[model samples]
Target: MSTPYAPPAGYGDISFVELVPLALRFLGLGLKLVFLALSYPFSSTKFSLKRVLWRQFVRAICPPSSIRQLQFVCPATGVLYQKYMRSLPNKPPVISENIGDGISLHWMGPKTNKKVMYYLHGGGFVLPAVDGHFYMLDWWRNEAKKRHGIDFSIAVLEYSTYLIDCTSSCQLSKARMIGLINFAPWPTQLVQVAAGLAHLLKEGYDPANITVVGDSVGGHEVIFLLAHLIHGHPAADVLNLEKPLAGAAALSPWLCFGTETTSWKQHGHSDVMPLGALNKWSGWFIKSRTRTDDSYYFEPALAPAEWWGGLEKVAKNVLMAGGASEGMFDDIVTTEKAMEKGAGKQVKLEIFGQEGANHNEALVEFACGDAPGSTNYRMLEWLKEVYA
Candidate 1:
């Protein structure tokens, strides 16, 4: 029997101490919304009224002031995803396995399914999986069959978020604990994702039949996972695979944690991601690091091109996509070029510049209760071709 699924400590519901800050955040959000509404006509043509509103809503809830502050308001992803899965009618069989070490893998189909897409969600590594994540995953599962006649399961890994540093006391002020809070630090996510892959391998699934996929930070994790497979991270255990996986895919993968590119300056305002949120989240992730020379995994764009030399040995193929209007466009292109230089013929990249496209466009659409758009169509088709 599998271990009973348990959510992270403080999985749902906010504490009394968080109420004041949460309330103040809401008040500030209201003010911002009012300002955006009044200034709508003067805003850039790059953003539609709907897109602008959505961006502000995300920005308001995910503030740059504190990581813990965002955690306090956002629902814990594991429990919420579980609830959403249960509520789905005629959905694929759901299997919940606590693969140990506080990491949970929620399989959308049975473990015996030969083909799998190991999905890692993106929320700056701080926010948990939202309803949109599940909705989009389920939609893709159905569409994969309907559109391409491919049968596959999706195993969504609910890795722990970086809430607070393990050594920091709860009594510390949010300001004092900004950079010091290290709960669920660098190697923690890497370890958990690798464990999820290991579990799939141990269950008799061929590495050649599995494709790892992620969005934004999840995409960042996918890239590093490939690097780790090639170079190996000392802090994490290794996976013993018989052969390269079928493929890997990332949508708007946050390649570099910094915002110093021309794309950032061009698309920051029009995109859904707030510049402040990126700054704060990247700072928290970097500051929580326990090592000094960890940029090979954390900052892949800045790493020497030789670091990804054996990526073709990790996966048979790689598919990376980004929206031309997204701030991470330049970084995505840079990372792609570096990987291509090393891995040669194994890398394929697509940049969609359709009107209104932004970072992780597929996910953003699902969040707004919109149907899957071009990016989703391309990803589903790519899965079919790779698995062919």
Candidate 2:
């Protein structure tokens, strides 16, 4: 039998330098809770006080400067407990485009070919831009070139958030409504972008080399895109309409929307997100934007198996990476099971065993200075195998 990995001795001991900041985080969460309780009404509140408390508790133990930052750190640090990862070499340049309302894409890597990785960021579908993922993009580019000698580009989707309710128009007609509702449909957007990538491929690039990767809700986007393609959506007409995709990867994907997962209980009091808050806020955003319940996109779990027909047949090379410690363990497991039930085949699952690694750890691993053994490496390897 193999022995489980353990962190260095005294890793649990807090240093004086780290204590003050930790204290501040606790204070922050407490203050946020007070703010919610005193100001926000329970009926209108999206998150629970307990969830806020849990976020604070976790932050005090291992704090990230902001909620967006936490999405990267929690998963990475928790999964790769003892390993030290190197920081990303350089930041990617942000490019703005007027698709319809407006959308931004963080372009990275050598722009040799249109073999791109469209990254859908994770933040329960409500958070702002994920600048934290820039380092990960840098590391991915370096690894792809080093291993496969093929230059890969990245397009980080800058979707509008319900929080900001930015009134930007995208080239796609649904952009403004999707942004306002904060109900960005994974299936719809995937088809739209895939078509766009297909167009780029037809213009010159290789269709077999394009890949899609997302984290958290973004992870869900990856699956949704594959599902959309398998279902024969018309969005492929915009692009060259290739077979399926070269590959896809999702890290810590938020699979189930209506279920009460363990993380829901553990972080129920989290200041950042309360249990069941996403559904309410996201649903409202969607209803407000679309002027309809249209629960299909908001509550994907309710969709029938037929809706995802042929997905497993097409995306046999899909890769899913998740942390064991995060609150979403049950949700991930359920999603895997649901995929098995729907696809009737084993989906690749990579569960990281880093201590304290939570929802944000995978993103954190790419940015950490001295992390060893990353799932990102595994993802890069898989991409090479599938696209080679």
lDDT at position 35, candidate 2: 72
Q: For model 1, how does the per-residue alpha-carbon lDDT over 1-388 read when each residue is reduced to its tens digit? A: 3455545554434566766777877798889878888899987765556666677788777754455566565666666666887797765445777776656777787777899999988888777777888888888888888888888888888774445542354321332212111235667777778888888788788999999999998898898888888987887788867889899988898888778799888998767878777776777676666666678788777877787787777788788888878899889888877887877776554444434578888898888766678888888888887786
Write down the lDDT of every candidate, Cα atoms only.
Answer: 0.75, 0.52
Which stretches of model 2 miss by more than 4 angstroms? 1-101, 147-150, 160-203, 232-240, 266-297, 302-307, 312-316, 341-356, 366-373
| Candidate 1 whole-model C-alpha lDDT, 0 to 1 | 0.75
Q: Write the per-residue lDDT of candidate 2 for residues 326-384, one digit (tens) a residue.
A: 66656666555455556655334334433445565667554333353466677777767
TM-score (C-alpha, index-matched) for candidate 2: 0.61
Angstrom error of the Cα, residue 238, model 2: value is 7.3
> What local lDDT does model 1 show for residue 15?
63
lDDT for predicted candidate 2 compared with the true structure: 0.52
